[model samples]
Target: MSEENKQIAQELIDAVGGLENISSVAHCATRLRIMVKDKEKIDQNRAEDIDKVKGAYYNAGQYQVIFGTGTVNRIYEQFIALGAPESTKSEQKEETKKQGNKFQQIIRTFGDIFVPIIPVLVATGLFMGLRGLVTQEEILALFGTSPDALSDNFMLYTQVLTDTAFAFLPALVAWSAFRVFGGSPVIGIVLGLMLVNPELPNAYAVGEGEADPLMFLGFIPVVGYQGSVLPAFIAGFLGAKLEKWLRQRVAESLDLILTPFLTLLIMITGALLVIGPIFSAVEAAIMAGTTFVLQLPFGLSGLLVGGLHQVIVITGVHHIFNLFEIQLLADDGMNPFNALITAGIAAQGGAALAVALKTRSKKLKALAFPSSISAFLGITEPAIFGVNLRYIKPFAMALIGGAAGGFFAALFNLEASGMAITVIPGSLLYVYDFVPLMLYVITNVIALGTAFVLTWMFGFSDKMLEEVKTE
Candidate 1:
């Protein structure tokens, strides 16, 4: 790590209640996720004031310090080198499970298990969008070929790039879930593979009536878990707990061989006989509910999702939406949720920019401007925690802006071909259609302009700027 990272690491440790107070430390895509023994001892304001620290927030029993993407990993290494105990995703999940009520714990567990796997999904989403772009009628015509005339090899390559992740989504979900539940990730993967084995008919095929589900134990019907979320996650959790229980009871000499064998034997049976069918039904119901909600009349769905999406982000439960968006893409080939989320994110940036423009203090402007840019680029912690949310009125104005934007998005029926990535980069996801692309641009503009105008009029005051300057 660089000297700057080392210094930032030390300041972060001190800011989060020092090394003694920190029980475990980890990093996600853009935050230093720390589990501390004494949350009250830490000064959140002081922590946010650190030069490299963009913002800080406590969610699901973890204090996450936003340091952006690349910088966070460096600071994480430095923090570990400085004697902060390194924590895995599983340890973090365990800590979270100890802190909350049953409902909160379930939500937190979902976030912990899914967050580490988002990058892979994001990459696959981008590829899906890119594949759509390259295979577009115009793009193909430019290459002297139509969709029907495209070569089988080219189509095969595109399928490999775009379909593999969703096709084996259960495996990815299971791997992450098992890791979060403190089990061997490879075993988790193998269990996931078993759920989607080629020997069994594909899940989608069974749903489409192209194949039949095999009968298990003469009663329960078993099918492949490909592209399924809840089933894989539940299986991984149960498998990990079972594996741990076996490890404790089994003899040490034969532990390695017998433990895995027994774990797999029991888990496979449980998954097929019980977990798979039940949770798959639950997942289907949830997806159906989500679809129904998103399809509500007069753009009410977008208004609700857009206005409150960032609030979910504040609690760090926003990661659950990744499953929703991915499922939407797999089933419908378009993600309208991403369109709504983009509006919310763009509103944050707009409010931040409004704050930057209204403030006379250079220090305040310095924080607001870059934070606004980061929000526009699909990251909003800096804008939300560092600027808008700090000023309650600005945050409220942003919510209204988001609601407006989302309303228009639903009215326009805006959609994206991808799950993650929004605002400027998200444009790539809609390149196959001109109208959706145009609506996406207009939706963001509505979010930005509405928030900017609203915040400028009602969200700020000279007194507030002066107080911010003094701080």
Candidate 2:
């Protein structure tokens, strides 16, 4: 290990009351999460003062210290070299259940289930964006073909790339939910398949009055669930629960065969008759509510959501937005949330840059500069947790910038073709439409410029950069 890393490891061990007092140690994307045997024995202020440690807090029964991203991984390596037992993030989360509140647990649960699926969604979004670009009249003119002619020959290929994920989205949700809930993943995926079985009428076709639903008992209307989120999520949850219950009662000798048979039969019945129908309606209601909020006149809703999003990022519950974005994309194939939220993110980066530029202290500059770049890359943890939030005024300036940008986005009806990215990389989402690309650029530039100018003017001062001498 390097001399600097070794020293950091020793200081961290001491900050948490020595190695013996630590129950476990793990690092997430940005924080070093450490479980302690006794909370009183640790020194939070000292932990925060550790070199490269931006801030520290106790949440969900773990002392989480912000070390940014790459830096945290290196420091974690040092902790292992110092004899701290390597533990999984799942292990830390399991222990958190004992102390985390019901609300926190629910939010964390959603986060866990949704985070794993982002890569697929991001890829799908890119496909859709590309399709939009190629179909544009301006682009197609260069190829000596029109959108209609291209659609006749190449639309099926586009559908395979872009539509396949949403066509059977339920299966993916169920498969992921099952794995997270500790049930059989194969069983969960199979159950999801049944929801979108080819035998039943398509959900979209029925919604458009083009196909009739299958009437079970001649009273309850039933149809296939395609591109649905809640139905699949709840089905996975219930399937896992029912499977576990069956396992407990089924005899050891017949367990394998009987458990699978009983679980499938019962889950299918419950999904079609009860859970599926109820949750789909609930999901529709939620989608409508979200649309209403985002559509509120003058971008008031965007202002509120954009201004507060980073604050919630600190608590790590921002992953909940993944569900909402997915549902929105399935509805209209457009994601206003993606466009609206970027303003706050860009503003945070701007505020951090302002601090980096204005600070005379080399150490402070060193920390804030890279954090600003990280924020620009769409992960704001380093900028928000490391620098902006540490100084109250910069965070406040970022909020104003975020709010202004969000308001403009809403006013102009700016939206993205996909979800799960923002800032620099997010430019890909607006590729299909010239207007969106232009509007997206203006919104974020306004946010960044507003924050940078405001912060450089008054939000930050040179006096705050003074370094403390140590023995």
Candidate 3:
């Protein structure tokens, strides 16, 4: 740790109370989550008073301190230096261990891992989804006559910005996972790109067949690492741990030479042999589980669809589900679950739109409007956090409303024939398959209308709604 960082960390620890008072310390994307045995053991107000500290919150049995951007490592080192005992000293472990059930743990872990990245994920994902909307028809029209239309510059830029992420999702996840695990995000990104490189054909399975190949250590096969979660996460987690350990152990004299070499050796080997397979298995398990749930009685499916849809959005793993929708659409030429999620996304938007129209705060309104539009396009965090979560009531109302929509869609067995950006008229691509097209349209329209009415009724108050237009 830098002397300056060490100083800051030490001072903050001292201010909070000696390391002995700290029951546990952990971190998420941008904050130091600390738990002290006693509320009075250390001065909470004093910790918050520090210049480097952004803010603090005591909730769900955790004391969270927001810190400077990218300061987690420094803070972590300082906590260690303060001679705080490891997990053995933690008082809350018993309570934390009892957190409901496996489903809840999965939900909690998913939230812990992905919530911090939602803003960026949604921004980039939305932009890509929108870009597709802008270029799809033109590309299709051009392709209708000439195959070369896709080669145009306008199409190329859009393709690069939007399709590139899917094409290189493994790399994006690697970086995001690295950030999550306290590693150099740049290194994680480079490692991710290597996994997906087309020239490295054998390196990973390119969506389609490729001629050239890249071998890992000249042997183990690297497969689709893009947009994958488990492999990158496993690799990045090991890499970060290795890096931290090496940086601490290597002598200053030979550190430069030994550190990078050992780190790379550990990461590459660990990723190729372990992380990759683990993630693949996880992917398989999830698909199996979802398939099982979908096959259940319609009410059960509706419940899972409604509840898990939001959970999926929260975890940023909905893209994997979206991929399933796309494949199902292509194979069966229709997908009912997709309709369920569409309703869920619409519910998010309805709730946010309600809050936007009812909130008195100008800043909140400004924040809510764009988010609501984004949710309409199928990105929901800005709506979820900025609006729905704040009002609290709206999210639950939306969820129940979403369940109602899902029940109706499932009862009708409405399926989208193809996936399209939600904002585009092209989202109507599968509407023709609707039995009694008018009923299908009305059903979907009612889904959104019901959500809106529910949110308005459940979320709006005379005072809040009246204060809304003040600005």
Q: Name the candidate that leads on TM-score.
A: 2
- Per-residue lDDT tens digits for candidate 1, residues 1-471, read 498889888988888879999999998888889999989988876787777677788876889888777988999999999999998976786677888677777777777787777777777777777777777888889888888987899889988887888788888888898898889999999999998999887988998999999986788888887788888889999999999999999999999899999999999999988998888888889999999989988999889988899988876668778779868876766788998999999999999999999988676787889899999999888899888887778999999999999999988788887778898888888775667889999999998899999999999875875465466
TM-scores, one per candidate: 0.87, 0.95, 0.52
Q: For model 3, how does the per-residue alpha-carbon lDDT over 330-412 read when each residue is reduced to its tens digit?
A: 22434557667766777777777776787675655665677677777666665675556545677776776677766776666
What TM-score, to 2 decimals, does candidate 2 have? 0.95
183 in model 1: Cα distance from truth in Å?
1.4
Candidate 2 local lDDT, 76-134, one digit each (tens): 88898898877899888888877867888888888888888878888889898888998
Give the least accurate 10-residue stretch of model 3, judged by summed lDDT. 417-426
Candidate 2 has its poorest 10 consecutive residues by lDDT at 462-471
Off by over 4 Å in 1: 1-53, 58-97, 100-102, 466-471
Clash count for each candidate, listed in order shown: 0, 0, 8
Candidate 2, residue 202: the lDDT equals: 95
Stretches of candidate 3 off by over 4 Å are 1-155, 202-221, 291-303, 307-398, 408-444, 451-471
RMSD list, candidates in order: 3.6, 2.3, 11.2
